[model samples]
Structure formats: C-alpha cells, structure tokens
Target: MTQDKLIRRVLKPVVWVLCLGPLGGLAWLAYSGGLTANPIEFLNRYLGEWALKFVIFALAITPLRGLTGWAGLTRFRRLLGLFAFFYVVLHLSSYVGLDQYFDWNAIWLDITKRTYITVGMVAAVILLALAVTSTKGMIKRIGGKNWNRLHKLVYLAAAAGCLHFFMMRKGVQLEPLMYGGAVLLLLGYRLVGYLKKRRRKSRLAVA
Candidate 1:
C-alpha cells in the first residue's frame, strides 16, 4: 500500500487502539479488583503518566519525521496530541471525580496549596487549549501564524508536566529524570533546527 494509505488506514487505527488500550486495562483492573487498596491513586497516576508520555511523543514527531524522511507522520500528530489531551482530562477527572468526589472547594484549595497540582493544572489547561484548537476550522480562524505561536506553549506545558511529575514523587525517581531528558532532547532538536534556519537566512541575505 501507498504511504498515505498506510498511515491513514493502518497505522492510525492501530495507534488509536494502542492509545485506548491503557484506559481499557485500567477499567478492567478496577472491575476485576486488581487495583490495590487505593484504586483512585493508581488511576490518577497511570493516566497522568500516559498523558505526559503522549505529550512528549507528540513533541517528538517533528524531529522523527525530519530524520526518518517520513513526512506522512505529520498526519498522526493531531491524533496523538488529542490523545494526550484525552488522558489528561481523564487524569483530572480521576482526581476530582474519584478522589475528591466532586469537591470543588477542596479541589480549589488543593490546587492553590499544592505546587504539583498547580503545575499539573497549568499543563492541563495548556493542553486543553491546544486540543480545542487542533481542528482545521480553529486553525484557519486563528490563522496559521497565530495558531503556531499559541501552540508553541506545548513545550512549556510538557516541561511543566515533567516538573509536576517529579515533584509529585518523593525522591530519587529515575522515571521523571528520564522524561526530563527526553523533553530536553526534543526541544534541543528544535533549537538546532532554528539555529540552522537562521544561519541559512543570514547567508542568503548576505549574498
């Protein structure tokens, strides 16, 4: 099959299933009494990790496509980004719906008092903006330049998310450090690209 057809017909569907698989497993665990004493905590952490993972994955797509010469990979970015948003929303839901039991007052206090929650909320809000504006209509309405400017916040959001995760954990966790490293790598790639582009422009202007 053609690359376009493969991306659209096969890869996309497979990715969709893989993305949803976590939630499905979580549900099954809860139903089967597999989650430990604190199911809410498990759900919250699991969903948040997956959300952050997808966000980082989305961030990595550009560099991957450029390196691998797979421009068609761009088609999957929106879906991946939206999945990041999906899992983030569910993460928040698990916190508020299951843990907080819809306690708005408590939730507000926690968000205000807890540094991790504050950062997590900020990241979530940023993801929400990105997700809402992911559509073609929204992109056109906002215009490409402004839309791109707004979407640049994804890096900040992902960085904040890594910080949030690290802060949430107690101490000496390799996982958060690895995530931080990954984010730096992806952002570093962009930085390199930007510098190269600027250099090229400078040479052209000089000529």
Candidate 2:
C-alpha cells in the first residue's frame, strides 16, 4: 500500500485507542481496587488529567502537522477536540454529581465563592461553545476567519484550566508544574509563529 493509504488505515484504530484507552485503563484500575480509598478524588483527578491531556493533544496538532508533514492529521483534530470536551464533562460531572452529591445550592455557592472553580467553569463554558460549533454547518455560517478567532479561545481556556489545576493543589506539586509547562510550550510556539509572520509581512511591505 502507498504511504497515504497506510496512514489512513492505521488512523482509525489509533484514534479509537487514543480516545477510549484511558477509560478502559480507569475501569481496569477500578476493578483491581487501584483507586485510592477516596474514590471520588481518584475519579476527579483521573478525569481532569485526561481532559487536560486531550487539550494538549488538540493544541499539538498544528505543530505536529508542520513538523511531520502529515497534513491529514488535521482531519482528526475535530474528533480530538470533542474528546477533550467529553473528558471535561466527565470531570465536571464527577465533581458536581459525585463530590457534591448533586447539591445544586452548594454547587452554585462553590462556583460563586471559589476563584479556581469559577475559572474552571469559565473554561468549561468556552470548551462547550467550541464543541457546539465544531460542525461544518456552523463553520459555514460563522465563516472560517470568525471561527478561527473564536476558537483561539482555546488558548485562554487552557490557561484558565492550568491555573485551576495549580490552585487546586495544596502545594507546588510536579504534576501541575508539568501541565503548566506543556501549556506554556504550546502557547510559546504559537507566539513565535505569530512574530515570524509579522516580520515576514513587514519585509514584504518594505519591498
């Protein structure tokens, strides 16, 4: 088979595993009694970590396509983006439903009173918006340029998410640091690209 066909053939199963493998792993751990005594905390942290991981993967797509010359990878970005939202929803549900015992009043108070929770809620809202507008019909209605500008909200969401994680931790743990560093790298890459394009446009204007 040609390289293109080989990639296509491998892509579907790889995406499935990448998407569902974490859930399977969680289930396996749960079945094995690997989750800590505080199962709620375990679920919350696990789902949140996976959600952030998916966001990082979504952010990496453009850079990976540029570096690897795999243009077809962009085709999977929407799916990955939705997966991020899926994990995020799971994370939030774990908190509100399991942790709070579905106490609407307490949840509302916590959201209002806690800065990190407020930040996380904002990020979730932005992710929800992005997910809802991921369809091609919405893209047609919104126009690509507008859609792109709106989607740039993902960077902000990631920042808020990292801040949420960092603040939620009791101390300066390595995990939060690692997630923060990865987000910084992704944002820094985009920043450098933006500057380079600006310089190129400036040179063209002078010419």
Candidate 3:
C-alpha cells in the first residue's frame, strides 16, 4: 500500500483504538470494582490525566512532523486534539455528576474558592473553544490568519492544565513536575521555531 493508504487504513485505526484504551480500562476497573475505596476520585483523576496526556501528544505533533519531515503527521493532529477535548469533557463530567452529584451551588463554590479547580476550568474552556472551531468550515468562516491566532491559545491551555495538575496534588509530586517540564520543553521548541521564522522573514524583507 502507498504511505497514504497505509496511514488511512492501518495507522489511523490503531491510533484511534489506542486513544480509547484509557477509557476502556477505566470502565473495566469500575465494573470490576477495582477503583479502590475512592472510586469517584479515582475516576476523575484518571480521566483528567489522560486529557492532559492527549493535549501534550497533540502539541508534540507539530514539532515531531517538522523534525522528521513526515507531513502525514498533521493528519492526526486534529484527531488527537479532539480526543483531548473528549477526555477533558469526561473528566469534568465525572467531577460534576459523580463527585459533586451535580450540586451546582457547591460546584460554583468550588470553582470560585479552589485555585486548582479554577485553573482547570480555564483550561477546559480554552480546549472547548479550540474544539468548536477546529472544523474546515470554521476555519473558512474565520479566515486562516484569525484561526491561527485563535488556535495559539492551545499553549495557554496546556500551561494552565499543567499548573492545575501541579496544584491539585498535595505538597510536591514528581508526576506533575514531569508533565509540566514536558510542556515547558514543547513551548520552548515552538518559541524557538517562531523566532527562527521571524528572523528568516526579516532577512528576506531586507534582501
């Protein structure tokens, strides 16, 4: 098969299944009563961590494609981003419906009073906006330049997500720090690429 056919027929389906694996595992755990003593907390944290992981994976796609010269990677970017948003929604739903039992008053209080929760909510909102405008129709309607500018908010969303995970943990934790470091590295890569592009443009303009 051609590379394009291989990606479309084999790789995409494999990735799709892998992305759903976490949720499947979670479901199995719930059914088997393997969520330990605090099922609600376990479910919330599990889904939230997967959401962050997907976000990082989505962000990594650009850098990876640039470095490897595999443009086909771009085809999966939107799919990964949508899965990130899917997991984020599942995370929030678990918190609201399972953990908080849909107590709007209490949920509002938590959002207002809890710093980590506030940060998480901000990240969720940004992801939602990106997901909503991810379509080709939205891109055409908004214009490519404007769409690019709006989508840059993904960096901020990823940063806030890292911060939220860091703050949610008690005291200091290695996992959150590692995730935060990964995000920093990805952001640094993008910044360096942006600077290089600007420098090249400036030299061209001068020439």
Global local distance difference test of model 1:
0.94
TM-score of each: 0.94, 0.95, 0.94
N/CA/C clash count, model 1: 0
Worst 10-residue lDDT window, candidate 1: 34-43
- Give the local distance difference test score of model 3: 0.96
Q: Candidate 2 at 46: error in angstroms?
A: 0.5
| Residue pairs clashing, model 2 | none
For candidate 2, give the lDDT of residue 83.
95
Error of 3 at 97 (Å): 0.4
Query: What is the per-residue lDDT of model 1 for residues 13-101, given as tens digits with 9 covering 90 to 100?
Result: 99999989987988899899988998789888999999999999899999999999978888989999999999999999899999999
Model 2 per-residue lDDT at 155: 96
In model 3, state the lDDT of residue 158: 98
- Could you give candidate 3's per-residue lDDT for residues 1-207 as a string of tens digits? 999999999999999999999978988998999999998899999999999999999999999998999999999999999999999999999999999999999999999999999999999999999999999999999999999999999999999999999999999999999999999999999999999999999999999
* Residue-level lDDT tens digits of model 2 in 83-148: 999999999999999999999999999899999899999989999999999999999999999999
Whole-model lDDT per candidate: 0.94, 0.92, 0.96
Q: Backbone clash tally for model 2?
A: 0
Report the C-alpha displacement of residue 120, candidate 3, in angstroms: 0.6
Lowest-sum lDDT 10-residue window in model 2: 4-13
